[model samples]
Target: MHGRQLCVCVCAAWFLAANGEDVTCLSEYYMGREGFRSVPLSPLVYTPIAHRPDWYWKKIFQMRGIDPESVKSGYTEAWLAFLFVEAQEAMTVCSIEGGRYWDCILDVRKVYDLAQGSARSTFAGRLAAVFGITLAAPDPLPGHLRLSLCAPARCTESQVVQEIFPLAVDMLMGERPQQMLGNASFRDVVVAHEVAGWHDFDIDFAIVGVNRCGTTSLRKNMELHPDVVIKGDEEETILSYELANRLLPLKAQVEEYNAQVQERITAKFKATGHRPHIVGIGNPLLFQSALVRQKLALMPQLKLVLAVCEPVGRMEKIFMMEKYCHDDLPAAQKRLVAWPYRDGSEVCFPSTSALLTERHGQLKLFWDQRIATAQHLAALAELFPSRLFVLHQTELRDTPSNIFNELAAFVGLRPFPEKIVFRRYNSVGGHRTDLCFNASLVRSLQRLLEREYVMQESILQAFRGIRIAARSTRCDLVDKVDTTYCPNMAC
Candidate 1:
């Protein structure tokens, strides 16, 4: 009866010591089973009993029939010995849990104090000298002793390793720290670091431009490539615009923006079964020089694709689209009029006659920046050098296969599918023939924009020379339209 009573008492004490508040630890035990059952010790509850030598002695004798006096006479030395053994066991478990092979001097003295002076300089030093881990004291807590175990540099490459290393070290030092394996806060830190690395590499290119050009069509076709992942809608304008405007600190905004982008790209790659080689954004408003500079500063390796059309045609399309809104779409007209312009002029969609007559100044100001498409592309080419790619809007419309093939090569993609079809998207509709003005007014407007026309011709010649040199042999897929349409019409 006494032996059975003693066995129950030992089991109960061992159970409590092994698991402080965890109910799951008790699930493995069979109530009426014979002999001893193995109950894995919880690292959180198992602190080395250095301060309570008498209790340690009793538990040791009860569990393993080892007399404390026979093992060692000095209490401090025995305690250090016990801690050394526990550290070894903890490190072994950590290694099994994905820690790399560490090779450093184990400095337990940095973590724990001994009455016999530094543990590194004593018998503890001799015992730990043969191991690969170095134990050091972490930042001291006010009411607790904190220890950190560091392995070789290569061991911490994994996010799991980064999280588990600290917890395992604390456990080895008998700190009884909380488990952080699946904790959200800990996981966020790991993810943030991973996202930072991801951002450094993923945004390989951008299609920044003049708004009315064929950016939408180019982006849509680019998305069809297996190795490309361009956002389906318009580019993420707020990212570049707000950052360039300095509404917030640059670093913080960049991190926040890239984190959102990274999530999307990750999900896309997971579903597509092929990792995207180049992720791009197509935001026409990013053509603003200030925004372009800001983007370059953020990603110096960014490849730029500038798509430009005849300035007058683009401006006319923009004006006609506005007119359609004002005359036919009342709700859209209300919204359009309320939209803010950088020049502080009231937004208006005047009749074509009024636009060519009274409101010409506002129209000129609105299209002036865009009309100088050659200057913008030249400036960007000078700034970005080989990283810049200029695409003619006409080619995008007439010979899309050739343009897309060239674009695919420029942005580092395998040649797109041979049977690829490029369809015009987001083309402006509802343009009225009555929007055309008198031929005298058209000549006057052409003379006003003559410099832009010359620059546009120069850019077309430059791109043509480049294409011819590259030996791009694809046949033009669509018939060429009269180039004189824009110059002849009062667009």
Candidate 2:
């Protein structure tokens, strides 16, 4: 466990129990002794239940859009099965007496609160209902109130990690509490159909983002091992294609494109099962849209990893990279498309400056979008805190070697066998960093990035409260601005 986590637990126990809240920890097997306090009429009995029968569950799985036969091939099967087992156990003690609404609501709220470490997305009551916990007489807890209660319940994180984590992962991944139950049931069917296997991976990492953040580089460096097969960039693009269909009514051509993307990704993963490849998808665009996050959640054991850099540098790189990624247009055509810019905004230029500026009302829009990303990361982190690692691009420049090692450790992979080397160069010749970046432009961009970072840091700190403190290492070089303007050449 992280040292900060230990301190948080000690602080919480001292505050809540000391303040007369009857927060009982319940099971010694899972919750241990210290984190929970007791209430009168709270039963001490705990009963564990096996997953539901396969015949009834198979249909339930199909309803949730999972094919039992296909689900067994990936990690999703084991995850769903574990969730079913927990749901069964939770349903048993949903209420103190016989499904008493207030009692059961409190019970489910406490468990999920601590387990999720924050207010669940307006689904606390519904989630309770899934475990057969009903609310009566008392009002359903306000979203924020449930959140406050849940935040403190994070004291039970270690217990959740050890025993109930996989189930919780399924629950969070599901569309609703009841939907999660279905997923759990399907998990059982898949596990039984597959094998009597032991030792499924408890932790896994996902490179999550809004695309163009060096997710590809992160995955490649981390997946150098023969055992690691990171998914091709196109596979991750399937989620985007899915989102595009939902956002805009697709023409037949677009629909065909989406089908191709999905088939390509599905086939790629299906082919890699022969070797125990620690599969990762680099769908950096996933962070931009809420729908993509929801779709990804269903595929359990995903650790959302985000790689962030200075807004200016990231925007600049993104602008440069987009030309290559979407490179069908000729140079003259691309120039024509970029020339008619309103407020200097063009598809070719990184338009993200509008999103990253520090103007008050404008800042809030950026804050909302960033906060949404953080929330997505937070939910995944709550499910598997150790699995989620947010890396900053500055770290790569600072301690490239250690960053690689840390990344290797994070993704459950061994680092490169050859001595890893850090190469420092931009698209423009880069023996010197200053030669590439205009001093005035760099200063302006740095200021903008720092402001944006402060806002992002605030949101991240609020959720996980883990601040990464790494000293930035600087390379000395002469400050000479490059004479070249934007490289107008098409990839």
lDDT of 2 by residue, 1-491 (tens): 34654564455556657777434432221232222111121211111213333543454455457666655432342433444333323323332222211111123333334333233443454544443444442245322211001112322433233222222333433422333332233222111000000112121456776344455556655554444556553435544564332211113333454354455445655875535346666767666544344344444565667776545445444333332222334552344322222222223322333333443553455344544544544444445444456666656555767777766666666664566554432222222122123445555545645555564465446544646432211111223433322232211
Question: What lDDT tens digits, residue by residue, belong to model 1 across residues 426-472?
Answer: 55333332344344544555666667666555555665453311111
Clashing pairs in 2: 23-37, 24-37, 101-134, 114-153, 209-284, 209-287, 210-284, 211-284, 211-285
lDDT of 2: 0.40
TM-score of 2: 0.39
